[model samples]
Target: MSLKVECQKEELAEALQLASTASRSNSPKFALKSLRLGAESGLITVLGCDGEMWVERDLACEVIESGGVLVDAKFITSLVSAMPSGQVALELLVEDGMRVQQGSAEYKVLSSDPQDFPEPPDFGGEGELTLKFSQLQDALDSVLYAVTTDPHRAILTGVQVSYDGATLKLVATDTHRLAVRTIAQEGMGSSLSVVIPDRALRAIRSLPVGADDDVTIRFGMGRLGVEAGGARVVAQMLSGAYPNWERVVPSEFSRTWQVERDQLIDSLKRAMIIASESANRVKFSGSGDSLVLTAKSEELGEAKEEIPMIADNGQIEVAFNGRYVLDCIQQIRGPGIRFELTESTRPGVIRPAEDGDDYFCVIMPMSLT
Candidate 1:
């Protein structure tokens, strides 16, 4: 119930904003709506939680008293944000709660009993995987956008993670489209597979970490936790069998086209102007050394554009949701993007033309009709 600390204004505000995402404003437990500020030694820990998720951050500050208390996440976040730049002092003046002071400017705030705050659940400490922060974060950026936002199909709301000790795989799907990213990892003991909520992965992706620093992950006992730099995030794993993602990927795509990445993006954006009237559908007709993209709407008329592309097959035509293709194309790294398909009725695959590219998107085609 008592804690006193002094920290840089900008640093404190940033930490509060990050942790505030986990606070549940409408939770029945008042403590769940607040953040726990614990001062110990020279470190100040700021933590916020709901029952299923939470974010904790460690900030280096001068501690006047080593103790802890629960302060309103929203109020404290805003309070720190509005304070003047420079050192801000926070102290527990009485049982009523804490005081925020910077020079002569002051604010009195009420805090909940620290004992009422639910302790963050422990994620298994064993079988941890440590990999470069950028590697892990880049993998997430490639796949997270495809997870379904529907709550009824909860299993599809998470990314399926599997580590075979040498490779790390992340996959997400919204039924209509699938995004998959994999990275090479080594010395990770034991095999691991679990579905972690997309929201949790996103929360930790931007953690303040050095380029060479590694991110440590632990998954066991129905939970997954991530720690990097001075921040930590944990979430309850979504339970249920993930779809047979491997089977969905085409093992033998007969048609492949290698086209400039920027060209496709530019053409798609232009075509979408007219296609927007027709559910973002863009028709593709690839033949010889050129590819033609066309879109039409009863109200907006029709439009077409063509670009040169080296194709393995003579010709083929298909239809797709332009936005879905754009989402996958934007994530590709190399200049040339490979488009693979067997027929108009089958799923189309979008991948980088560069060898050893571990990211790809499998997009289902819309009816050409």
Candidate 2:
């Protein structure tokens, strides 16, 4: 097969970068570390996969001859990115290699048989949900970090997505803490609920979705596909039931406190320094308008900081992993944060002080000794 193409260096590098996301960092199989390049009808498509996840990128280019070739993902991406900002030319050598040339520099990279590259499954299901890029990006940023990294619990490594035409909710938990965010959506005629892997969700979020772009999500053939920003993303769905997060959240709280978001985060960060060697426990006790954050460590001494807050329903004291609290705090956009507790031992619910805000998190209390 013969092929030749010319495209802007920046455009080619971006396309290869997208394809490299699917290529594993270390793989014994050469094909898994490679990306497939194909050209047809004045367009070049790059495909990459690592068995489970796959990516494709298409860009306009001058296609002199149509053919396909498999080239190392990292090598090709790096070569294109280092080239000068202008047209980069690629041609299939007579001896079955790819010749990439730009200006006075030229490199011939070996090409594997394109037929050996596993093709990605076609994704053509009817779009079940349509959400704006901002909304989806917000949801991902708010909850993706909470997904569990423990391989033993596969379900915890995925973000639970539930959409009911108007409201789309994303929830993630790592057993120690849970994050939930809901955003308004439009153009969804039916509801969709699935547990999508954290990696896949991250890939969708990283796509160049314009501020006005609407992402269409589809599910079929035991996989989830996202179409947005002129690209399509597909991944295998996690095959287990996600924990019932709603039930774990406190239904009622005996005490509530409203505190400045910055103040609380700063105090926790200082307290966390002392507890770094320990379990990172930071105790919170509040009465009336006074709140104190305290942490003690056997090897790192102790820390105490008082924060101003508005408390109701009497005094309350709770202990939590300072890191968990900090993680959730960083995601809050409002100036004030509201934390509610049923008891010191029960999980505490945190939300933005802004009423009717749909973002919240639950932190399981750490043991106090």
Candidate 3:
């Protein structure tokens, strides 16, 4: 028996986009690089995985027959994307392989054993929370940079996704710095928390979620799953407790300065060019109504920028990893960026300079030397 399904070329293209990232093209396990297609009553589901990340996207189509096939993700994706904006048909070959056809063009591609594909983890509970796509994506963009890239520090490579009764929060830290953002939403009445690999969080962004749509998150059976935008994603939870990031955030402030967001970023970028070759450190000195940014190197030279500021308190001097400050300010969209400092020895926060905002970053100060 052969599996068959017919779908619009654009529909197939969209579905392929959602599943393509799960392919590990260089993996020794060929099945891991393939897309698993399962056709049932009236819909066709495409599944892809790269061991750590997985995506399952459903495409609306006419299922001429009900069956399944696993084909190379790259090959199928290329074939589908090149097809005309019309209908396309996919069918399993008589003896082996699968065939894809559009108009006069056709291609037969080798297949993998469907059973060899690893299944997505079973997420059993009712959805725990629902968040708008923009909300989650916004928070992810702000905090993901702080996720550590060190392989040995596996726990720091994942973001802590948590929800209290009223807020959904994402927190990530790399010991040197921390990022936290909490968005107000209503969904699950109780609290829920999970540490999800940054890789998996990236895969969720690739799933077809639109900026305005809502994404539903469910947790159970040692897995976390999200359903939205015609796709469902489930991944195994990273096995470790995230650090207590709250303790690292400085609660009291000795000085706070408000500066134009674009101006600060521009000044930092110019300073970064010189700092990158040296210590990657940028020092901030705030006194009276102006903040001066200075970076120096023995080999490359130094850069000095004076930015107008509204310092609320004491004269302060602090040095921080310039890249860290850039990362935090780049995510903030408001007109003004706020810098709250307790001392040159503690972490300083960069946040939108508005009355209230959902995002904030705690960057540790570096020594001038």
Candidate 4:
């Protein structure tokens, strides 16, 4: 027996985009595979993955006949995404494969053994609290930059998620810098800690955006499962405990400065133009009501800029990687930002002055040798 399905072009396109990241080989697997047709609910389960990440989408389909089969995810997705935006029909072919038809265009794609595909990791229990899609996405976007790509330290490779009933905090650090973001949730729940893979978080960002409903995140056993929009994602959680980041963040600072976000970012960019390759160092000197940014390179020329700042403490000077400081500033969402420093050698904290349950970035000072 054969099966037929009709779905919107956009839905298929988005699903393909999310699945493309999961392809394991040089010739990427199809974006749609492991299709299971359910006669009772009129929903078709579409599964795709490479090995590390897996995504599943359930689409409402008019099943002319009740049956199921596996097809290449890449072929189906490419064919559907390239087709004009309209209804597309997928028919099971007798040759142990499937045929996709859109208007005058029709293509046949080979099938993979569905039973060979790895099963998605089971997410045992419901999450502690559900969060809005926008909130989660925004928080991730604000802090993902600080996640370490360095493989030497495994803990810094992923984002640390901490939840304590009232607030959910996501933190990532690379030793040189750290980014911490907090968001408010509705329900009260027990405290939970989980380190989610950076690749999985990036995959979540690619999922259909602007979803009104809350996304369900389940952390149990060694896996984290996220269900949002009409799709679901399952990934293995990073093993081992994250570092004691709180201790690394300085508690008090000798000097605190508040400056415009754009101005600081612009000055850093200009200074970085001539910064040394070995150490993208930029100097920051605080005075009465202004801060000076200076960078000099042996090969290139030196550049300096003076920007007005709201200095509350005594004058101080610190050196840091301009790229790291600019990365933290770019993640900030507001007009004015606060920078608290303890000494020229200690780490400094950068956070928004207004209390809106946002993000905080901490940067370690570099020694000038």
Question: Global lDDT of each model?
Answer: 0.88, 0.86, 0.85, 0.76
* TM-score of candidate 4 on Cα atoms, chains taken together: 0.81
User: RMSD, each candidate, Å?
Assistant: 2.8, 2.8, 3.2, 3.9
* Worst ten in a row by lDDT for model 2: 123-132
Alpha-carbon TM-score of each model against the true structure: 0.88, 0.88, 0.85, 0.81
- Summarize candidate 3's per-residue lDDT along 1-369 as a digit string, tens digits: 468989999988888867867777788888888899999989999998988668889999999999888888888898888888998999998875888888788888898668888988676884376767787788889899999999999999899988878888899999999988878876643588889888778878776768898777777777778878779887777887788889988878878999999999999999998899877999999978999999998888989999899888949899999999999989998899999998898889889998436899999899977
Residue 344 accuracy (lDDT) in model 3? 92
Minimal lDDT window, size 10, model 1: 182-191
Candidate whose lDDT is highest: 1
Per-residue lDDT of candidate 2, residues 60-148 (tens digit): 99999999998999899988988879999999888959999988888999997888888778755744677677877877999988999
Q: Give the clashing residue pairs of candidate 1, or none.
A: none
Worst 10 residues of 3 by lDDT: 181-190
How would the candidate models be sorted by lDDT, starting from the highest?
Answer: 1, 2, 3, 4
The residue-by-residue lDDT of candidate 4 on 61-94, one tens digit each, is 6667666656655566677778888887777778
For model 3 the TM-score comes to 0.85
* Model 4 bad stretches (over 4 Å): 1-7, 25-44, 50-52, 61-111, 184-188, 209-212, 273-279, 297-300, 356-358
Residue-by-residue lDDT tens digits, candidate 1, 169-266: 89999999999898776785457888998778877786888867877888777887887778888888899999998888888888888899999999
Per-residue lDDT value at 237 in model 4: 79
